[model samples]
Target: MASFQIIIIGTGIAGLATAISLSQKTQHQILILESSSVLTEAGAGIQCSAAASRVLSSWALREEFEAVATCPDFTEIRRYEDDELIGLIPANVNDYSTRLRGFPHWLVHRVDYQKILADAATTRGVKIDFGQKVVAIDVDNVEVTLASGRSLRADLIIGADGIHSRTRRSIPALKDVVPRRTENYCYRALIPREEMLKNPVTATLIDNQSQQAWAGQFKHIISYPIAKGKFYNLVMTVPDHGDAPLGQYNEPGDVSEMRQVFKDFNETVQAVLDTIDSCAKWVLADLPPLPTWSSPNGRVILVGDACHAMAPHAASGAATSLEDAEVLGLCIATCNGIADLPRAAKDYEHLRRPRCERIQEISRENATTFALPDGPMQEARDQIWRAQKAMLEKQLQEDTPLAIPAEDMAQQFPHPALVQWLVGHDIIEEARTHLATRKEIHNIL
Candidate 1:
């Protein structure tokens, strides 16, 4: 019954970023549909690594981001049992930004970040339809049918929906592709900064402005400051039995029971848990790698978690999604007309798939590292961290740039290498080069 040049499903960060990016390049009419009646964030904190920060800055959101995000001085890894420091990675925001011409790694509440993207989307005149549940889609026809029986067509349809993407099922090839349990569940909690400062156990962490993590047998806890240190976000991940009913990602977990899981943790970790008045339990799910991210016809495409959902171990989910949007926008803008949509869609998938797959694999591996039970493997990992820390400290003493490319880093620091691979990438520039090469090839052909 309605039409547009582009229809983006889901209004999360990815969807909004896509709309904004596309609108900036061309006057394509963009519509974003959300199943929820309201635009809100149920998630907790999110990391905006250097790559994502650069994307946001390019969108003229630097001021907005600085207001909502905190740049921690460093990240430390400690043993969960006795809290012995294993490693410390200097996260000097200023130094990195200056050397790389990129923004610092930032921590922010999810809601605040979403607000920034949503505001940017609206300013770009992207139409957003809330409470519109897409029940079915026809990728070949570039059409989607709403639960209310309304059908809409677009020149191109983008599935930016989250992990449980309904739009993903529209592609016949992905109909059977469902997200499976990663056997990890998490308790996400946010503590007010004032409250944290009041407690002696949490005060030192807050005072240092350091992001910290404790690795134990079969579990880990990550804590950091967000909202410019107005609040501290803590995420605790542990193995679960996949007990939640089908179609359910989380259930209300009792605070006492949740605290008990970390009962044997170090005093600081347990103390932090004790202060948690409430928390949300989330079961981590990930999609097995798909053979393709787009339909054969290329009229419909998947972006963000729809195509490469992964465990949150590497903390690159949002960054990858943002990169996907940047690439997708670049592809669409290269199109000469509606007739070129299919080719452009194919280009987007080609440019994005490999990197996304690598991210998914690394994130899964990182989850294993975090939840490794006490054993030789865990001890080896800790030793690697200690060696890397010593190397980093030597570099600092020698007054050298702390930019160690993943390939150049010690083998035990694979997760950091994955992270370095992510933050060091310039997706926009990559997209430009890719499209430019394609343009030459097209002309020759």
Candidate 2:
């Protein structure tokens, strides 16, 4: 009999959530190793979409989430240079999420959201050892060597360490692993609502209640409300068309550097530059599609950002990560705990790989859909999108800002049922099919 239990080697959102969900399947001791002292977020805002909301509701944290998260009024897409409105995604003061997923899509500050998740896990008896960085590990023995000189072992090890995952390297099942930067450089900052309100340029770009996106050649700038409309989150992305050196995201830039990156953006967008106190420039990174998400020996597994780091265009990263958690959670529950850890790990890899790969493809293709290069084709595409949107808006309410409110949504859409399945039941069937004959799907892609 193995004295080793479930050892999770990171305390990120994906790691913490894994511990919480797995804790339910048995009384097996769970240990979390987090490198950072204070568990906080690296970014400002995140759009937790329907796919994510469904899983969240299952944890029965809706009321608690509602208390901290903001349901924005819109995600109106537009042209970057001219600021021409192209598509309006309604996000108003309604239960639109409930329409899509019997719940809602929430845009919350990263730290605030992480706190919600962290608190829930700790309250449920997950033992999180913070301030402990993982230095190395011996996968065969299922032992983890911590930076603090403590050694821990487990029957199962989870590599939720993130994109630069240490455990991902040890898995013979997924070698030739390299995280490529997607040529998207993002500059992000926060603004006080009062300051944003005073500027005509900024005001035109966004109100306190809605989200705004202006698409350009190979890029876009988007802003939205957070912290109960007290502050706004803004992100501007541009084209490099070439990859950056590994770890360039580690550097922070001042406001001057940010302006230079988006120099050709509209004047309204420039208003953000003046009011911006500071900013961070990030070179987004992600892994190529893998044939399997499991170790050949079956003691280690990958999840969340490590497995599927899609482009942020569709706002699907967080959503997909939660989906990863749900699939792995159900797998453990069915297997009867860490006692069946190997089987559960294999099941998790099979269920998630294809779904995650599809999402990755769609996300990569999606970024360019709105921001085509400047030329004749760009103008024509913009005009067609606007014409189509105008045709659709005829049936909607005008007071509904430029973005689609959940109420304005087509009642027959499939978003709601998906949501229902996400929150109300186990998606064991879908997971099984995804990983079904996983070898064929891996080669096909």
Provide backbone clash counts, one per model.
0, 9
CA shift of 431, model 1, Å: 1.5
Q: Which 10 consecutive residues of model 1 have the lowest summed lDDT?
A: 406-415
Alpha carbon RMSD to native, model 2 = 6.0
Off by over 4 Å in 2: 1-4, 92-94, 200-206, 241-244, 248-250, 337-339, 398-445
In model 2, residue pairs whose N, Cα or C atoms come closer than 3 Å (at least 3 residues apart or on different chains), thus clashing, are: 73-91, 80-215, 89-404, 90-403, 90-404, 90-405, 97-103, 97-104, 98-103
Encode model 1's per-residue lDDT on 1-445: one tens digit a residue.
1233789999988898888888776778899999999886865788887878888888888899988888876688899999999987666534753354356778889999998899899899999999999988888778999999999998788999988888889888898898988878888888887878888888777666778989888889888988877888988998888775534554666799889999989999877887788888888888888988888777788888889988888788888888888888778777666667678877788888888887777777777787689989988889888987887677767877656564322223344564566676777887787788873334210
lDDT of 2: 0.69
Question: Candidate 1, 247: how far from true, in Å?
Answer: 4.2
TM-score on alpha carbons, each prediction: 0.94, 0.85
- Using lDDT as the measure, the top candidate is 1
In candidate 1 the C-alpha lDDT for residue 401 amounts to 61
Question: Which candidate achieves the best TM-score against the true structure?
Answer: 1
